[model samples]
Target: MCKNIQLLNDDFLQDPYRDYAHVREECPVYWHEATAYWWLTRYDDVHFALRQPQFKSARLHALFDGIAPERLSRFTPLTRLLESRLLLTDGANHQRLRSLISTAFAPRHMDLIRPVIRQVIEDLLGEMQGRTSVEFIREFADPLPSRVITRILGLPAEHYEQFKSWTNDIYQFMGVSPVDRTTRAEIASTAAVEIERYLDRQLDDCAVGGGPNLLSVLKSASEAGERLSRTEIIANVVGLLNAGHETTTNLLGNGMYLLLTHAEQAQLLSHDRSLWPSFVEEVLRYESPVQIIARQLSEATEMHGVPLPAGANVLLFLGAANRDPRLFWQANQFDIQRQGARHLAFGFGPHFCIGAALARMITVEAFACLSKVWRSPRLAVTPRWRSYPVFRGLVDLQLHVTWQ
Candidate 1:
């Protein structure tokens, strides 16, 4: 319980960068008694924790065992499903899962899907023809990724709205610290079961030689003697659907927020389409969609001269690391042209985002379309951010855009 360190408060929520900067400068690795976890704020420390083998990601099982013992039985199906997800595992299992899933999300696959993504973007923007103002999150940011992922998963187009709702409920459990763990877990488990059943049905159909969707790819890999199990397939499909939808949705929303606030950078990018790639990277670095990631220490270790015992939960603040002055010059500034803007927005090492390519492709095309079709897009009202500690995304971005 460090008196000087405080998160989970309004100030931190409103401007987390300021709090993160202070922590990086004052105490790089401080223990928060309130949350019962160690905070890693500096760039080097967070980076090391992410890549270090000793900091394991497979502790969620143990973590939940301690948090809600009464609800454990009810959550077993969901827990087992999550444990089978590639993101929650490490080492050999993680590698195997990643390799199998990578086939469906390969760079070449993303390239092949680029035209489809562009068409979706064009159709979305086209729908805004007679609009003076639009709720960007609903109209464009949120729906784009949801629709794209649903299409990729070979789900019915009519189910896109339901898919988005399910993913949102799951994210509410996954991303935020819930006040009532019992209730949240119950709701999330319900969603997880529904998703699993749907995916399970899809897998059954794909097993009988269905279309060439992501589920079919995973099914083929499994039948071809891969170590992937049916449970793992269902869990990872749920993972892919959630990851594919939520993060990209946030990226588009946050990127537009950054560009709108930094008028000069927006103007620069609007005039020069070539900078969209770098601009996308800058948006990732500036206001990373996924902010905090947690890791458990596998062995007793010393970081910044502070001894930490094995099994200690460490929260690596990726958002803080991205803005660490040691890593980026003028870290707080949003300069798209800034060279060497390497960041951990998608994380690092073995656990880097599997859909990074797809997310970037979606974002790049999003900005390209906006640059071409929208003129002087500005915030129509003050934007509201979602109150999730781990995810930094806007609830809605109302904007006034003139048709070009």
Candidate 2:
């Protein structure tokens, strides 16, 4: 039954939670022949797999090395960039990169940025005033994070539009089922070069007595005896830019979709604003922005009585793990009030998302603002989900919102 699961197909993209539920029940540890990866759907399996030393994130370099030269040539730049990203490395290299980058992304710094995030949200909401219908993704969801992240990174406000485009291109190359790998690679490579150059200029500027933003903070860390090379700095800055906005954008869009569809839940939260944080958590569990996380086996192992060979690619279905009935009561049902269990939306263990705090802050503020301003917001049209296999988000979320 698991062998037949087509994760990249339209049916799966349209409705993966239902399929994942079926797979989790029938075969928790399933091998996907099409993509040549093992799919782990159960909560315990995925939770353990993430922290297991044998399942490594840095194996992509080895995996790509075995592919045909012609096929691999196009991905050279992307692979190189991925190799540098903290998310794709392991062991000492991963630690070094993560530690250096962590300074700029510290929780205290994120808290300091809260006021600015609130202002950004306010400005975005202000634009929607007097409007009966608005496209949530473009008007609110997209710009809020994009603007905030750009400001945090010290990038000029004028480049926000370009930054969004570049990040989208980069994500396409990194997507689970990208449309036309050749095209995506070209766009991603070009964007990579341009973004790196931009970061280089920022680094140069920060070298002369740093300023207030993240780039300056990173520079301070570098000057304070950290062994961060220029390439590592560029890689992390690019990583932060891409990782910073995309997931949060999806979270906001997916959250709104959940709220609008579950009108009772929306009304409940609107009246009681204190539930916004819990509502965000439930939205993450219900429709995780990132549907899957990849790992590669370092050695032969048996998981859940199923034997897996060495060098095997593994896909941890976070979307499924979050919905596993064993973990949460009424897992399939979206309940903002439910609490206790932590979801894998920001992932788990050592490689947990560094931007989780910032994402949470932005989401809490966004929801708080929406609940206060928007009255009886309902879906204007059926939400169109993006077709990326690993990302669960709406392409456009049109809502008919009555201003309070």
Candidate 3:
């Protein structure tokens, strides 16, 4: 094993799969500094940790250590708000609420909205007209995710700016300095309150048989003796919006970045579009939008032959898992045509991203629109990625595109 390795360096930050390769080869599950969380690197370890019911999510108020109790207490209401959602809830609450809400995301229902999603992507791409080159991140990725998520909540297009602002606040993690975190947390709470109120109003309207949006879907869920509370409904609404927006945005951005870098792969897929699905899967495996998720030991659990005592906090490194060489030889190689593309990008087991299908469809269509509109795009600025233990993504990257 290499001595005194640090996972939070420039090399790891720029292309973490390299670090994943090292750790998976040497120490599959080694403790790490920086965050001081037990880190899992090998593919099997991460997949097993996520599947094990002994590990639980709705974690410490502060993802970082040494947070004050008083400050942590302030996060309780918000944590409760977070925990009410499907990802945070476990066992029965998770199964029940998810079983009901899962209907909203039924494959047939998602297919119903494909045309709308396609239209939204084309419209967003159309807005990039007149320019031979544009920053694909701003022109394409950002607007595409924001608009699609807004449509999903059935929020009016006029209110999308509010949703955009709210998403920005929620997506903040280790990228911000210590001093800025408090203010960002405050903004997140306030935004959560406002958005929930908007959802509450919509739910109330749907209760009066108003319309058949997601709100109405939740209303029907409640009336069908599912016993969902107002808080639960609010939690689901905010959680979906927060979950869908930036992660999908970054997926679009990073996927584009990857394709733009690998010219031959891009041209190959451009010619035969049926490879789009596997191509997106490989992108998720390669440059995953969600880099990490935290879990606490609900009970004593041994992972990768290392025991995590009950109540011990651990960080599951999704980025590392995607690059585990044991899982895939030449794991660092970004090959769209490769077989067996299972990645931890959407996580695993009970907490797997419920909107994975929707997010996948959105990304596929967004890239499809881009493929139609632009022949090639060169990056203007190297991407500036946010290095948070909780989120893995680029905050911004400029692109210059050439249309045919």
Candidate 1 residue lDDT tens string, 1-404: 23465566767776798778878888888988888889998888888898899999997664454355665898877787788888789999999999998888876556667777887887888888879899999899987987787777677678777776776676666654646766777787898888777778767865433433677777887888867898888888778877778789899999999988998998787678899999999999998898998888889999989999998989999999999988799999999999874899999999999989889989998988788788788898888777676888998999988988
List model 3 lDDT by residue over 24-81, tens digit each: 6787667776556677776777888899887887553444344565676655545556
lDDT of 1 at 103: 89
TM-score of decoy 1: 0.94
Q: 1 or 3, which is superior by lDDT?
A: 1
Give RMSD to native, each candidate: 2.2, 2.4, 2.8
Candidate 1: list runs displaced more than 4 Å: 1-3, 62-70, 207-212
**lDDT tens string, model 2, 1-404?**
65487766888888887788888988888877788788999999999998888889886554344345677776666666777888888888898888988888787677668988988998988888899999999899988888888788777778778877776788667765434656667778888777777778878875333233888877777778868877777777778867867689999999989987898898788688788999999989999988898998889999889999998889999999999989999998999999778899888877899988888899999988888788888888997788787778899988898998
What is the lDDT of every predicted structure here? Answer: 0.82, 0.82, 0.74
Estimate the lDDT of model 1.
0.82
Q: Between the candidate structures 2 and 3, which one is better when assessed by TM-score?
A: 2
Candidate 2 residues lying further than 4 Å off, grouped into runs, are 1-3, 62-78, 207-212
lDDT of 1 at 175: 55
Worst 10 residues of 1 by lDDT: 205-214
Number of clashes recorded per candidate: 0, 0, 0
